[model samples]
Target: MKLLIYCLNYAPELTGIGKYAAEQAEWLAMHGHDVRVITSHPYYPAWRVADDHCGWRYQREQRAGVTVFRAPLWVPHTPSSIKRLLHLASFALCSLPLLAAQWRWRPEVIFLVEPPLACSPAALAFARLRHCKAWLHIQDYEVEAAFALGLLKHPWLELAASALERHALMHFDRISTISSSMLSLARRKAVPDERLVYLPNWADLAIAPSASSVALRSALGIPAHAVAALYSGNMGNKQGLEILAEAARLLAGETGIHFIFCGAGPGRALLEQRCQDLPQVHFLALQPAEQFPALLGAADIHLLPQRADAADLVLPSKLAGMLASGRPVIATAEAGTELASLVSQFGIVTPPGDAQAMVRALQALAERPARRGLFGAAGKAWAASHLDRHAVLARLESELRRLTEGGGAGTRGTTLEGLGEK
Candidate 1:
C-alpha cells in the first residue's frame, strides 16, 4: 500500500519523533510499500535550518527508499505563543498546495506526526479531499503540552484549542501514539475506542551497537580507565537537568565516577555554564545517530532525568536505545508514570530531580558490579522482546494495514480496547 507520512521534522533533527518517523518510512518502503514523507526543512530543537542548506519554498528528496517532501517553515526560538502560532500557520498554508499535488494518487493511508503544530488542519484537509484513511502518530499532545509549558495562557483560548484538537482527532480514521498514557488521553477526548491503537516507542537493534562501551569511551576522550555515567538527549524544561548537575557535584572525588551530559537543548547552555569549572562532570554536544550507540553503550549507568512535573506528558525515546545498547539504566522519574513503572519492573527508580538519591543509586550500583551486569542483561532482554525495531515497525505496519484493509483479526487479543472494536 502507498503511504504518505506528514510530520514537522525528519532525519538529522536529533529528536525521537524524527527518528521514529524516519525508521517507519524506511521500513515500510523496504517492505515494498511506497512511502513519501511530507515534512519541513530540518531545523528542530534549535529552531534554525542548517547553515549550508539551499533555499526552497518547497522541494522533494529521496532518502533511504522514501520520497520526502520538504516545505518551507520557520522555527520558533522562545516558544512564544504568537511566534509558534505563525510557525504552525506557515506549515499549514504550505501543506495546502503540497496536498493538492498529491491528492491525485489518493494514497492508501495518510500518516500524521503532530509537532510543527498545524498538522491537524493540513492532515484533515488532505484526508477529507482524498477520502483516504488518516492515521495520527502522536508523539506528544500539543495543547496539553503547550498549556503545561506555559506557552498557551488564556483560559478561553485553551478551551478553544482543546475543542479544535478533539474535533480533528475525531475526524481521523485511526489513531496511534507512543504510550498508554497518551492513548488514554486520546480516548478521553471522545475518540471512539475502536479507532485508537497503541504504538510504543521502538529501537533499531541492527544499528544499536552491541559493544558501545569502548567506542563511546574513545569518542568522548574519556581515559581508557574512567567510569562514565551519561545522560544524553534533550535537556529541556521538562528535564530537571539541574538535578544531574547537582548529582555530578555531589559525586565529585567519588572514585572512578564521571557524569557526561551529551545532546543539546534549551537547558544545555545553562547546564554547561553552571558545570564548566567542575572536574567530575563533562559537557558534550549531540553526536550523529550512528555515533550515539557507543556514547550510550559505554556508560557505566544510563541516567534518565525528568522534572517531577512532566511525568505525564513526555517519555524519552532514548531509553529504548539505551536498553538496546545493553546498558543498565538509572531512570529517576516519579511514581505513577509508565516510565516509573518500567523502571520499577526492569531498572532502578528514584524521586524526580533528587540529586542525592541519584548519587546514592549510582554509587550503590558502582559498588556492586553483579547487579549492574544483571540490570544490563535484563534491559537488553526486555528491549529485544518488546521494543525491537523490526518487531515494532512490523507491528505498526500490520496495524496500519488493519485500518486500511477490509478484513482481518483486529486488536481483540491486544490490551487495546478501542482499536478494531469499530
Candidate 2:
C-alpha cells in the first residue's frame, strides 16, 4: 500500500505528536508498505525550527525507509491565538505544491494528522480527485480546543471554524483519534460510527527501568534519597505548567523532594522565570531518544498537569511513556474524563490547576514507597497490555490494508458539495 501522511510535525522532534508520526511512518515503511510523509521542519515543543532546516526551502530525505518531504513554515517565538492561526495557514499554503506533487504518486491512502486542521480541505480534495482513501487521524481537535481554552473568542470566528471542522470531519473516509472521548466527539460531529477509529498513541514496552537511571540521577544532582517529581515533555499552554512551578514553590522546604521540569516550548521561558527562586526545582531541555527511557526511570513520580479546558480536548502523548517506565503518575484532570480515569487506575488524579492538591498528591506518593511500587507495577502492566507499539501499528496496518483493499464501510462518493462549498 502506498500511503501519504500529511502532518505539521515529524521526526527528530523528541516529543509529542511528531515522535508518534515518525514512528508510525517508519513502522509502515519497515513492514513493506510504501510510506511518505509531508511535514514541516522539526520546530515543535521549542517553537524554533532546527538550524539545519531554518530556511524557506522544500527538502526531502529518506528516514528509516520512509520518504519525508519537509515544507517550510513560519514559527512564532511566542504563539498567541492569532499567531497560531497564521502559523497553520502558512503551512497549509506552503505545502500545497508538495501535495500537488503527490498527484503522480497516486497514493492509496492520504493520512492526515490534525492540529493544523487548516490543511484538511486540500487533503480531502486531493484524495477525492484521486479517488483514494482520505484518513484523518486527529491528535487534537484544534478548533474546539482553541475556543474552549479561550484562545479564539470571536463568536463569528467560532461559528465559522466549527462549521468548517464539522464539514471536513463528516467527509473523511475514516477519522481516528487518540482517545475514546475524542472519537465520541467525532461521532457527535456527524461522523458515522463505522468511520471512527480509536487509535491510541503507543508505548515502547521495551523501555524497562534501567541502570542508566542512576547515572542520570547523579548528573542532575538529584540526591539518591530525594524523590524526583519529573514533568517531561512539551511545555505548552495546554499543559497548565504554571501549577507545577507553584507546587514546587510550596514544597520548597521539603529538601528530600525535588522538581525537574524537562522539555522545551514557548512556555519554557515563563516556566523558568517562575521556578527561578525555587532551589529544589531544576529544568532540562528535552533529552535525546536514547536517554529518554533512562530519563523517565530517573523520576520517582511523573507530573502531568493539564488545563481544565484542555482536559478532554487533547490527551497527552507523554502519558504512554510515563506508564511504560513503571513510574507512578500524578496527573491533573477532572473527574469522569478519560485522562482522570486512566491515571486513577495506577496513580493519583487531582483537579486541574490546583497547586495544593498536586503538592499533596506528590507528598503522599513520595511518602509511600510501597504504594508507589504497587502503582508503578500496575502502570507498567497496563502499558504492556494496551500500548505495545508493534500491536498498535499492526492493527493500523491491517486497517490501512482493509481501506485500500476496498473493505471500508464509510460513506463513499462524497462530493465537494458535501463540504458546503460549491
Candidate 3:
C-alpha cells in the first residue's frame, strides 16, 4: 500500500506529535508499505526552526525507506495566539503545491495529522484528486483547545474557527484521535459514530531501563538521600507549568525532596524565573532519544501537568513514556477529565493550577515509598501490556489495509478503545 501522511511536524522534532508520526511512517515503511511524509522543517517544542533546515524553500530527504518532503514555514520565537495562526497558515499555504504534486503517487491512503488543521482542506483536495481515502488523525483539537484555553477570545472568530474545523472533520472518510474523551468531543461536533476511530500514541518498549545511574546522579548533583520529582517534556503554556514552580517554592525547605524540570519551550523562562531562588530545583535540557529510558528511570515520581481548560483537548504524549518507565506520575487535571481518570489507577491526580494540592501529592509520594512502588508496578504492567509501539502501529496499518481493500466495515473496528480501557 502507498501511504501519504500530511502533518505540520515530523521527524527530528523529537517530541509530541512529530515523534509519534515519524514512528508511524518509519514502521509502515519497514513493514513493506511505501510511505511518504509532507511536513515542515523540524521546528517544535522550541518553536524555532533548526539551523540546518533554515534558508530552504523546499527540501527532499529519505530516511529508513521513507521519502520526506519538507516545506518552508514561519517559526515564531514567542508563539502568541495570532503568531500561532500565522505559523500554521504559512505552512498550509506553502505545502499546497507539494500536496498537489502527490496526486501522481496515487497513494491508497492520505493520512492527515492535525494541530495545524489549516492544512486539512488541501489534504482533502489531494486525496480527492488521487481518488484515495482521507484519514485524519487528530493529535490535538487545535481550534477547540485554543478557545477553551482562552488563547483566542473573539466570539466571531471562535464561530468561524469552529465552522472550519467541523467542515474539515465531516469530510474525512475516517477520523481518529489519541483519547476517548477527544473522540467524544468529535461526536459532539456531529462526527458520525461509525467514522470515528480510536488510534492512540504508543511507547517504545524496546529500550530497557539502565542500571542505577550513579554517574548521572553525581553529574546532576542529586544527593543520594533526596527524592526527585521529574517533569520531562516540552514546556508550553497549556502545560500549566507555573504550578510546578509554585510546588517547588512550597517545598524548597524540604531538603530531601527535589524538583527537576527538564525540557525546552517558551514557558521555560517563566518557570526559571519563578524558581530562581529555590535551591532544591534543577533544570536540564532535553536528552537524546538513546538516553530517554535512563533519564526517565532517574525519576522517583513523574510530574505531568496540564491546564484545566485544555485537559481533554490535548492528551500528554509524554504520559505513555512515564508509565512505561515504571515510575508513578502526579498530574494536575480536573476530576472528570481523561488524564485524571486514566492516572487514578497508577498515579496521583490533583486539580490543575492548585499548588497546595500538587505539593501535598508530591509530599505523600515522597513520604510513602511503599505506595509509590505499588503504583509504579501497576503503571509498568499496564504500559507493557498495552503501549507497545509496534503493536499500536501494526493495528493502525491493518485498519488502513482494510479501508483500501474495500472491506466490509470501513470504520467500525478501527477504534482502539481497547487501549487504556482497563
TM-score of 1: 0.92
Model 3 residue 40 CA deviation in Å: 0.5
By lDDT, the best candidate is 2
235, model 3: CA deviation in Å? 0.9
User: Worst 10-residue stretch by lDDT in candidate 1?
Assistant: 412-421
Model 1: residues >4 Å from true position, as ranges? 54-56, 206-212, 219-225, 408-422
* Model 3 ranges with Cα > 4 A deviation: 206-209, 410-417, 420-422
Q: What is the C-alpha RMSD of each candidate to the true structure, in Å?
A: 2.8, 5.2, 1.9
Model 2 C-alpha RMSD vs. true structure (Å) is: 5.2
lDDT of 1: 0.76
lDDT tens digits by residue: candidate 3, 1-422: 99999998887878888899898999999999999999999888887888788725799999789999999889889998888888888999999888878867789999999977888888888777778999999999988889888888889988888888987888998898988888888888888867777888898665344664445656788897789899988998789999999899999889999878889999999999999999888888887777777788888899999998897899999999988878889999899888898898888999888999999999999999999999988888887777888777877887798789876343443333365231
Steric clash pairs (candidate 1): 193-418, 194-418, 213-298
lDDT of 2 by residue, 280-321 (tens): 888888999998988898899999999999977899999999
Deviation (Å) of 267 in candidate 2: 1.3
What local distance difference test score does each model get? 0.76, 0.88, 0.85
lDDT of 1 at 385: 78
> Against the correct fold, how does model 2 do in TM-score?
0.96
lDDT, candidate 3, residue 236?
89
